[model samples]
Target: MSAPAGGRRAAAVDPTTTVSRVKAADPRGHWFLLAVGMVLLACALVLNGYVTNVAGETQAPAPATDVSTPELDDVRSGGPVLNLTAGAASSAGPAARTVALTFDDGPDPTWTPQILDVLRRYGAKATFFAVGSKVAQYPDLARRIVAEGHEIGNHTYAHADLTAVSGWRLRLELSLTQKALAGATGLHTTLVRPPYSSTPAAVTLPQWQSLRAVAAEGYLIALTDLDTKDWSQATAARMAKSALPAKGRGAIVMMHDSGGDRSRTVKALDLALRELGRRGYRAVTVTGALGMPSAHQQAGGVERFTGWALNLAQRASGSLTAALSWVLLAAGVLTLARLGLFAALAWMHARRTRRGRRRRGIARWEAPPPVTVIVPAFNEEAGIQATVMSLVQTTYTGELEVIVVDDGSTDATADLAAALGLPNVRVIRQPNGGKPAALNTGIAHARHELLVMVDGDTVFEPATIGHLVRQLADPAVGAVSGNTKVGNRRGMVGRWQHIEYVIGFNLDRRAFELLDCMATVPGAIGAFRRSALVALGGVSVDTLAEDTDLTMALCRSGWRVVYEEKALAWTEAPTSLGQLWKQRYRWCYGTLQAMWKHRRALIERGPFGRRCLGYLALFQVVLPLLAPVVDLMALYNTAVGDPLPVVAVWAGFVVVQALTGWYALRLDGERASALWVLPLQQFVYRQLMYLVVIQSVATAVLGVRLRWHTVRREGTFGGTLPPQAAPQGALAERHPDAAAQP
Candidate 1:
C-alpha cells in the first residue's frame, strides 16, 4: 500500500474487515458473559445486605391472645365457619370421617422427594403450601407434586408475615408467589396461607384485615385447625403426637416438609398416616375434604409468561453465582502467585548483585573503541538540539560520531542539528518513514562497528556512552540496555512513571539478565553490535516494538543481552493521562505482536525458546489479562465483604511492593522519597496501565492494525544538556536562502 498523506502509511491490512469477521463469528457471547457477571455481583451485594440486616434484628414475640384454638362445634359444623371474615376460611367441615393434611415451607429437592415417595406408597393425598422462591428453584419438584394428584398452594414469596408487613408488601407477596407457581408448573392456586397464622380464632386484627383485603383479590385465606409444631420437635414420636386430630373431628393438620433437615418430619409423616387410617379416617387434600373448589387451575396467558420469566431468572442467577465464585477464586490464586514471584525474583536479584560485587572485587577501567550514535527523529524539533548536544559533550576519550536521521519531519529538526556545525555531527534527511525505517537508514550510513540507538527526546549523562560500550568487549554480548529514568518528575503522572521505571522495568531487567532471558533492550537507550543488527535484518518493520523484536532475534541467534546499570539516560515521559495511555497502548500492542511473531521459539531447544518464551507467556500475557479481575474483586470485597481483611491484604501487598521499590532505588542511587507515591499509584495509575493492556489484547484479538501514535514533546530534559554555539561559517549564516525553507 502507498503511504497516506503526511508521509504516514495507512495500515496494510484493513481493520474493518478483520473486526467484522470477529463479530460475525461470536457476536454476543462476550457481551452476555459480562452482563451475567455484573448482574451476579449486584445480587451478591443485595443478598449480603439482607443477611446482615436479618442477623442484627431481633424477632418480635407473638401475642398471647393469638394462641387460642377453634371451637370443636364450629369445626364439626364446617362450611366456611360463619365467625370468620369474608376473605378467610377455617375448614371445609366435611360430614364424612375425613381429615386434610397440609405441609408448608417446601419444594426442597432433598426432603420434598422423600415426602412424595411416602405419600405415593400409601394411597394418601396432601396439600403443599410452598414458598414461591423455593418453587422457582426446584420447578421439577413442583411439577411432580401436581403430577402425582397433590394440591399446591401459595405460601407467600419469601415466607413473609402478612400481619407485620404493609398492605402493598402483603399483596406483592401473594402476587409473586402466584407468578412463581404459575411459572414453575403452569398452574395457579386460590389457597393463600399467611405465614405465622394457624387457626382463624388465633389470627390478630391486622391479619384479619389483610385476609379480607386478599379475599378481594380472589384468593381464599386458609387457616389450619391442627398445629403439629414439627419445626421445633426433634423426634418423630413427638411430632406424630402433636399432629393427631382431636375427638375424630374433621380438621386441617399443619406440618412442615422443608426449612432444614426433614428426616424427623418424614419419619413422623409415615406414622401419622398409619395411625389416622387405623382410626377409620383417610387423609385427603384441603379442598377435597372441604368440597370448596379444586385448587389446581391452569395459568392464564399473562401468568404463564410471568412463570417463564421467573424460571429463566432463577436459572440465570444460579449459573451466574457459580461462575462468579470460580472467577473470584482464580483471581485470588493469580494475585498471590504474582506477589510470591515478585518477592522471589527480588530476592534473587539482590543475592546476584551481592555475589557479583564480592567476586569481581574492584573493577578495572579501560578506554572504549570507536562508536556511532543514531538518533531518529520525526517532528521532534523541540528536543533534537539538546539530544545531539548531549552526544557531542560526552566525556569518553574514544572517537564518537553522531548521525541524526530526520524521518520526514515537517519541522526544523534537521536544520537545528545542522546549524550546530559540529564536524563530528551529521544530519541525514529521509522521506516520511516510521522510526524503524529511519533507524535502518542511519544504520546503513553508520561508520563504526558499534552503534548506539537513542530516542530524540532523550538526554544521556556524559559517561553513559562509555559505560554502555564496555559491555560489548565480551564477544558473546550482542547488545547492552542502559538504565532509563524520567527527566520530568514534577507531576503526579511523571512521578508514577519514574517509580515504575525503577521498580517495574529496571528490577525486572536485573532478574532477566541473570537468567539470560532479557526480553527487550528499550528503544530509549540501547547499544547494538553492527554485525548482530545486520544478521537480524536491521530493525524489523512488522511490529511497533522493533527494539524488542530485534532483541529477541539476537538472543535467538546465540548472543547475550545484558543491562548496564551505570549508563543512565533521562527521557521525557508523557505528562498527561491521554498521552501516557496512547504510548503504553502502542508499547503493549507492539510487544504482543513481537511475541506472536517469535512464538516458534517456545519449542526451540535453547534458553531463548524455553525460558524467555515461558516468561513472556506467564508474566506479559496471562498476568496482564487477569490483573483487571483482581482489581474488581478487591473493590467487591471492600464494598460487600469485610473491608478490614481486604484492606489488610491490600496494604500488605503495597508494603511488599514498596520494599521492593526501595531496594530498586537504592541499587540505582535514586531518592527513597519516591516510594511514598507508590501506594497512591495503585489507585489510578496502575489501573490505567492494566486497562491499556486489556485494550491492546482486545485489539489484537480483533485483528485490528493500529497506526503509529506520535507524542508531542515539550523538551522536558532541555536543562540537562549543555548549550551549543553556532559555528561562524555554518549553513545558516553562509546560505540563508537554503535554511529558510520549511
Candidate 2:
C-alpha cells in the first residue's frame, strides 16, 4: 500500500496514523454503512409505524396486550433448533425452587385467545412464540394474547423449517419475521426461538452471519426442555390430562394458539395452571421462573442494547483512553528506568554521530565502542560456522570481535568456527551449562567493552550486527535488541511463528520503545555494555528467560534498553506446535518468573516493573490467564445461546497490531513476504500465546519448574500448532550472504 520500493509515495497510512485517517482508510467502510443504515432505519421505522397503525384488512391486527412476544431474532427453523448446546455453560450449584413454561409454534386464531383467557383466569404468565403469518391474519387475536400479560417470541412468518434455508435464505427468514413482527406489534424483540432448536444451519457460515439474519441483534434463543405437543389435535379432556406436568420442576409446555382449532390446548392450559397452583406450584415468566438474569447488562449502562455502529463509537473513545493511559504509564516507567540505560546510550550515540559511519545524517552520536559478538553454541556443527561468518562480514568498523563459545559440543562447533579463519574471530570451549551459561562464558572472556549476544542457529544481516552495536553507541542506551525473523517461515508453524515474532515481539517492543522502557533485549540478537553485563552478575541459567532476565536486570540497574528495529536476525521458528508450545510456555513462565524476580520495580525502585498501572498489569500478568479464559468464554458463548463480542474484541487488537507490525517489518527490512503472516497471526499465534500463558500459569502455580530439555524436531511446519504451549525450535543466526547467495 505504500507504493512499493520506488514509486510515487501514495497516500499511505503509517503507524502513527490518527483515528481520522484510520476511519477513512478502514476497508469495512463502517461510517458509510452506518449512515446508510441510519437512513434505512429511519425509513423502516416510518414504514413500520405506517404498517402497524393503519393496515386495514390487508395487514394483521396488532397483538393483544397479554400475548407473549418472545423476541425471535434467529427463528428460521424448519426443524428443531438447539439454541443452547449441551454442557456449554458451567454451573456451580443447583436451583432451590423454580419453574419455566414456554409455548411454541402458535398464535393461531382458535387456540391462542382461548389459552390466554384460561391463563388470565388462573392469573398465570406464559411465553408465546407466534408465527408471522398467523399473527398477520389474526391481529386482533394477537392483541388479545398480548393484553393478558404474557411474553411473545417470533416463530418466523410461517413455520419455515430452518433446514430448508441454508445461507442468506436462512437469514432472510429470521430477519423478515423480526422486522414484520416488530412493526406489527410495536415490540422490540430480545429473545429468539428457532422453529426447531441450537446451532441453526443458517449461522454456520460467514455470509449468513454478517447478514446477521437471526443472531445479529442482542437476542437469546429459548432453550426448551419440555414439549407438550399440543399442536396435535386431541380431545379437550385428553389434552388436559396429557399436557399437565406429572413431575419435574421446570418445563417448556409447547402449545399452539393458531393453526386448526385449539379447544384441547385451551383446556390443557386451564388444567395445567390450576394443577400447578393447586399443587403449591407457581407459574411465572421465563426469567422469573429460572430466577436468573437472562441478559448480563453491563452494570451502569444508559442503554441496554449496543449495535455494531454504537460499539465502534464507544470503543473509539474507550481505546483512545486506554492507549493514552498505557502511554502515560509506560512513560512514567521509562523515567524510573532511565539512569542505567541512558548514560551509556548517550555516550555511545554521541560517539557514532561524530564518526559518520553511515552516510545517514541525524543527531547520531560518536561511533560505538569496539563491540564483541558472543555466539553461544552447543553441538551446533551445522550452522555455527555460518553464524560466525555473518558476524565477521559485518560493515561496522569502529571495532568488533566474534567470540564463539563452543559450550561442550561433541560436534565440530569449535572446528567450524576455526575453519572460518577470520583473524579476530575467537573460539572458546567450556563445559555445557546451557545457553545462558555459554553466554556468560563468552561475556567473561571477551576483551571488548560491549558484548553482542547471538545464538548459533540464527542467520543475520552483516549490517544487523553493526546496527545492533550502533544503537549501543547512544550514551542513553544500555542495550539494543534485534528483531527475530522466521527462517522456515515457508511452513505453517513457521508462518505462524513468523507472524508471532513480527506481530507480537516487534509490535510489543515498539510500544515499549515509545514508553522508553523495553523490558527485554532478547539474546536472539542483542548488544550490551560490559559494565552493565558485569553489574548484573552476567547471564543466569536459573531462569528460562535468561535474556529477559538480563534485560530487566540492566533496566533495573538504570540502563535504557533500546529495541534496534534495524537489527534483523533470521532464526528458525518452531517447526511443530508441540515444540512451539514448550518454547512459548517457557517464555511465558520465565517472564512471570522474571517479573516475580523483579517485582520490586513495580512498587519500590527496582526492575522496570513499577511502570505498569492497573490495566497494563492485567495485560502483562493477569491477562495471560484471562486470555485463555476469554477464549473459552467465546467458545461457550457461541456454543451456548450466548455469543461473546468476538469480532469486536479481536478486530480492535488486530488494528493495533497491524499498525505496529507494518512498522516493525519496515524497520527490520524484512522482505514483504513476512507481512503475509500478519492476518493468520490472530487465529493462530495470538491464540497460541494465550494457551501458553495459561499453561505457564498452571505450571507455575503447581510449583513445578520446566524440564531442562525437550524433544525438538527440525522439520517444516505442519497441521495446527499442536495444543502444546511450549518452546518449539532452536534459534540460529545465518551468515549475511548465506541465503542471499542463492
Candidate 3:
C-alpha cells in the first residue's frame, strides 16, 4: 500500500483501507478465470445448439435418381442387415416366424422408461439405438436399457444424419456414442443404425458411402424392413399395421421412444407385440433373430474413462447454462427497475427544485462568506497556471483565496503557479503524500469556514465558486457537488466520457440529493463546510478515494450533500483507450475500497445505507458483474434464434438512454447535439467500462493493492482562462501568511 500522509504504515490487510501488499498480484489468477469463463461460454453455446438442433438434419432427401449399381441392387434384393466387414458384402434375415424389434433415438427419461416397461411385460427382447448426447444426459436410463435384458446400439451423438455431416463429425458421432454407452452400461455396441435410414431399398448413394465407412470401422449396419413412422404421431392402429410383416416372413421393425411425444409409439408397440405373439411370431433382439453373436462387448478402460469425462462436461455445461439464464433474468429486471427509478426520481427532483425556487427566491447568503479554494498539485504543471488563474478570475462577491499545495512535484508545478504573482493565491510546498494527504495539508492552512476543492487539471467558470459556495447558506447542507464537464470532447473517447458524466453521474446526483444519500462529492469541483471536514477528521488517508470516503462520512453523520448544477468546471478527460482504462480502474477500485470501508453504514439507521449503499451495490457492482453474460446471451440469441427481438430490445434501450442523455445535457446547459454519441457508446465504450469494473472487483477480491498512478494530463484547459481581475477585497490584495492560519 502507498504510505499514508504521516509516515504511518497500513496493515498487511485492513478493512478500513482495503490495501494489502502492492506486489501481491497473482499473475495467473484473473487470466485463468477469464480463460475458464470463455470455455464455459463455448460450452453453453454448444449445448444451446444441441438442444435447439442448430445445423442439424433429421433426414435427407430421397435419392433424386433411383440409379442403382450392382452392389446397390444386391443390397436391395437382400434382407434388412448389411455387412461390409472383411472387405466383403453380406446380408441376412431372421428365421421363419422370428421378428427383430428395435428402438431408435432413445433412452429418453420420459418415454424410454414406459417403452421398457411394456417390453418387459410382454417378455420381448429388443435393441435400443441411444444417441450419445441423450445417453450422457440420461446415463441411468442407458444402464436400465442394458440391465433389462435388452441390447443397445450406437445411434450417433445428437442424432445427426450421418450422410449430411463431415467425415470427422461422423466418426465423432459414432465414437462419442460408444463412449457414452460404455460409461453408462460398461458395454459398447457394434450394431449401428444410421438415423433417417429405413430399408436397404431406401438407402441413397450418399448413405451407402457412409455405411461403408461405418462398416470399415467394424460396425454392422442395421436397416429396418418396416419403418413404423411413429415419429409422425401416426395413429396407433396405423403404426401397428405398419409393424406387421407380409406372409409371416420374419422382419426388422423400427420405432422410437424419444425425440418427441411418443404415447402413440408406446401404444403401437404394445398392440404389435400382442398381435405378433398370437400369430405365432416371436419378438427377439436383432442378434437373436439372426442367430449371430451378441453385438454388445464389455467396454475397454479408455472408452469408459473418456465417456465419464464427456458426461461430466455435459452435466456441468447444462448446470452453468441454467444458472446463467436465471442470473440474466434477474439482471435484466434490476436494470429496468433502476432506469425507471432514475427517470422518476430525476423528474421529481427537477420539479421540486423549480417549485422551491418559485416559492422562495434562490437560497443565498445575505452576506457571502469568505471562501478558500484548495487545488492540490503533484506534477500538474500542465494545467496549474490555468487552474490558479481561473480561481483568481472567479466573480465571487466575498473574500476569496486560492491555495495550491504542491505535493512534492518533481516538475515546475509550484513555479508555474508562483509565476502568476496573484496576491491572494498561496502556493504551499508539502512532502510527497497522496491526494488525501495533500488535501489535508491545504485544509490545515485554509483560513475560511467555506472551502472548495478542485483538481489541479480543472478550470472553473467565472461564476462557479459563487454558485458552489451559496449552497452552504443552508446550515444543514454540508457540501455541494458542482457539475463537471469534459473539456476535450472532440474525440470519440472524450465524447463517451462526456455522455457518462452527464447521463450517469449528474443524473444520479440529482436523485441522490432528493433521497439524502449523495455518494461522492467529485473532486473536480465541490464545496464543503470547513466545520464538517474538521469534524470528520479532515480528509481520510485510508482509502484511495478521499472525496467519496469523506462525502459518505458526511452523509452518515446526518449532513446533507447536494448537487449544484449551475456550478460548472471543465476537466480534461483521458484521451485514449489505455488512459481511460487506467483512470477508470483507479476510480472503480477506489470506490470499491470506500464502499468496503463504509459498509457498516448499511446497518445504521440512515439513508446513507438504505439508499446510497444499496444503489451502488445493485447498479454499480451487481449489474456490471452480470453485464458480460447479458451481452453473451444477446449474441447467442442473434446467432441461434430470431434476432429481431434482440435488436428491438437493444434499440429500445438506446432510445431510453438517448432521451435521458438529452434531458441531462439540457439540464446542464449543454448542446443536445452531443447526444448523438450516446448510441455508439453501447458498442465499445460500455464494454470497456464494465471490464474495468470487473477488473477492479477482481483486484479487490484478490487483495491486490493497485499502486496509484498519475494520469497524463493533456492540459486541455491550459490556455483557456479569462483575464485575472485586480485584487478586489483588501483581504485578498495582501498575500496570506501560509503558516499564520490555524
Best by lDDT: 3
Ten-residue stretch with the least lDDT total in model 1: 13-22
Off by over 4 Å in 3: 1-29, 55-63, 631-649, 724-742
Candidate 3 lDDT, 310-401, residue by residue in tens: 87777777788788889877877777776678878888888887787779856677787899999989999888887888787766768998
Q: Give candidate 1 regions above 4 Å deviation.
A: 1-99, 158-176, 194-217, 226-233, 301-306, 361-367, 395-397, 514-516, 606-656, 659-663, 723-742
**By TM-score, how accurate is candidate 2?**
0.50
Question: TM-score of each candidate?
Answer: 0.80, 0.50, 0.91
Clashes of 2: 97
User: For each predicted model, how many residue pairs clash, with residues at least 3 apart or on different chains?
Assistant: 1, 97, 0
Task: Write the residue-wise lDDT of candidate 1 on 1-742 in tens digits.
Answer: 1101133222221111111111222123444654586566666544333222321112333674443234433433454322244523454554356778889988888999999999888889999999887787788999999999999988877777676677787787788778888888889998877677677556565666666667667776567877888878458988887777778778788888887888998999999888888888888888888776788888998998987787677656556556766876675666566556755675676676568657973233355588999998988888888788878776666789999989889998899889888999999998776888888888888899899999999877767787788777766788999989888888999999999999888878877787788899999999998767765667888888888898888887778898877777878999999999889988988899989999888887677777777777776777766666566656766775578988897898788778777888888778899998988998899878877777777778877777677887887654224453221112112222221100
Model 3, TM vs. native: 0.91
Q: What 10-residue stretch in candidate 2 is worst by lDDT?
A: 17-26
Q: Considering every candidate listed, which one attains the maximal TM-score?
A: 3
Q: Model 2 segments beyond 4 Å from truth?
A: 1-368, 612-617, 636-660, 663-679, 710-742
- Using TM-score, rank the candidates from best to worst: 3, 1, 2
